[model samples]
Target: MGIPRTPVRGVAALAALAALSLTVTACASEKATGGGGEASAPSAVGGDGVKTGPGVTADKITIGLMTDLTGPYASFGKSLTQAQQLYFEQANAAGGVCGRQLEALVRDHGYDAQKAVAAYTEIAPKVVALAHVVGSPMVNALKQRIETDQMLTLPQAWATGLLGSRAIQVTGTTYDIDMINGVDFLTREKGLKSGDRIGHLYFEGDYGESALNGSKYASEKLGLTLVEQKIKATDQDMSAQVAAFKAEGVKAVLVSVGPRQTASLVGVSLAKGMDVPFVGSNSAYSPQLLPTPAGPALLKDFYYMTAGTPISSELPALKKLAADYTAKYPDTAIDSGVPAGYSAAAIVVDALKKACEGKDLTRAAVVAAHRGQSAWGEEFGTIMDFTTFDRPASLLSYVAKPDKAALGGAVVFEEATTSDLAREYRVPVG
Candidate 1:
């Protein structure tokens, strides 16, 4: 069954939304720390507190990371590991942070919360803070403990429920905020008029649940009708859900599963003639996931949001980072998680550089520096900001599509559109 299509206009509406987002983010930034701070260029260290070069010396500073190196999100987790190792390795080669070399102690929790807790405690005393943590539950399990102990956590994705906390730095827009922005774009820019039926195909977990809830909240807020489908991360079958969406006549679908599951859902949806465009958070938007058995066929109209520009040759920062990474680790591939891992590491390094201001590199000093500093990095279109109370101030995401021609015959990478709808939702900066 086919549904009535609503004609949408984009050029002007998207531009207006972008301007509005910038203003809102600026107001939030002023509220975050009360004043505009100076913006720094490419150097990792900021101000006088930061030790130049790879300053993570054995006695000075040690960074610990808890990741799912061999679990459900292992693919992304592995890329994160590579990013961290490669970033620190380069930092060390430069000189080190604060004249001290950066040291990263990473452990695998298999994406298990209990195991993550155990690993957190085990790694607690060894490092200054936990940086670039991967999973929602794992981070949730350790949030209180990290806060109580006054440690820094750079969570890769955004969750609004995580706001107003001290121990974390969110990399993207909050789930609620982002959903609202996405809905606004769909309705206003994409002409997804009011009363349009929206669909959700989410995994059955906290991560999925968060996205689902956010989607519902946004839909209801914007007067959009909705259909819901729940799947497990382990589930390989999505025909039933695809059928349901088709029958319900959903105009657009919001998916919250990982890469494999997302591909499966898209595959079934495409094969069954379900042409509804699907939108997803960062988790579902992987270059590696798009080339699986039934990937391209399913993800034809697939669009997902990300917090950064991603690693494209067009972005000089990303280009430099890619060059650095390739020089350091010649065998690895640069996928979705690689840039994120670098950004996450960059956030932590920014904080540490601030924290190390005018003092010997110590955990206490690092924590203090993070608390006292106003913001990190130039919010140059990326969601990297922080304050004393608002740990994760902003998030940035982009819309990307599979590039069959560019990736040779494989079509393993996602090429970004010049104006991604996701950019309209950037949490503004002052």
Candidate 2:
């Protein structure tokens, strides 16, 4: 289960990678034009006769996205995509990025890494960058392509195993760091005491294990007892797991699986008369959880932690996003994932503008612009320089309690916070 982790690139490695991108771009240009001068490279309209990258034409700059539109995490994927699509549309209406309108090319991986990799392969050569890549499992599968292909990806998952590649950009805290802060919040606010029995339900892959490591570390540090169980990301029933936790009389539960698993655990436990708090990791929450039959049950005991501020936040950036979203799609409900998509688009837009400033836009130019950033903000949190191998750019998460009145929306009670354990956390790079 212990695969070697990837290490982050330092300044020298980043420059080397950037140079690789440029070199690949040049080679691709040569190949596409039959040894002609400056062809297949993305070029500016009315300025140059040469193109720079795969998906950039004079009128549009396309971005590729892979997500679970019909799989287990379908709700989050759908909502995230909606936000991204609408945001880009709004941006284009006012003024396009670098004089070219932005376009989103989407593919559904159905939560399967194999399919995700295939989809990525099919679209990798047709876009300037990846606008969104969902799921930790998908990221695990795409690691090599990201590192070698210079296909910059904006990932929704924050597992540490996928953090090493400079091509993949993470916008939030790693699952491990989020859990450390999570446990700290539990101990301080929920009166979770030393020696108390806690249960964790997680998937058996990188994403789940990343969060489990945090809970295990937190238990050792806080003098608490952790009883752990593993499940698959696609698990739909958890009666046995609930029974096991019930038998052990765990005071609270922590989950690192998807929303279906979380719902099953909470619902089954309640039906069995073994009720307890079930705190969820970012991936374990979705707005769809509220309308389910388990909604009432969750209202009694569910809590969630997110690496970014909620879409409902009063911050100006979030306010503009929420306003734009509602104006475009008035009937659609909002969730934490919407802001995530919005922030990622903002970052991509920022980078694209920088990369295209009085120069031809290329994938390498985007990479260089991203690496050159000393400080970056998506209006949700500060992004650390991945070029420096800062594994977790930020080590904080916002904790929220469910609001029954709003159905699925949560009232964020705590701002993103970091504990001493989180600040010093480290994980292996594959």
At residue 414, what lDDT does model 2 achieve? 90
Model 1, runs deviating above 4 Å: 1-60, 188-190, 371-375, 388-392, 405-430
- Candidate 1 local lDDT, 1-430, one digit each (tens): 0000000012343244344334434422322221111211212343445432222333345677776555555555656766787787777887867666776777777667798888877767656676777776677777788777667787655655455666676655555444555555466546687788988877675656656666776677668897989886667567788888999999988867766566667777777888767776666655544345555654467766555555653566776777777786565555666677887777777667775556434544565666564545443246344554443354333554545443211231233222233344332211
The superposed Cα distance between candidate 1 and the true structure at residue 80, in angstroms, equals: 1.0
Error of 1 at 375 (Å): 4.8
Candidate number achieving the greatest TM-score relative to the actual structure: 2
lDDT of 1: 0.59
Residue 374 displacement (Å), model 2: 3.7
lDDT of 2 by residue, 7-51 (tens): 011244335434533443333232221111122343343455433
Question: Model 2 compared with the native: what TM-score?
Answer: 0.85
Task: Candidate 2: list runs displaced more than 4 Å.
Answer: 1-39, 42-51, 358-360, 381-387
lDDT of each candidate versus the true structure: 0.59, 0.71
RMSD of each: 12.7, 11.0
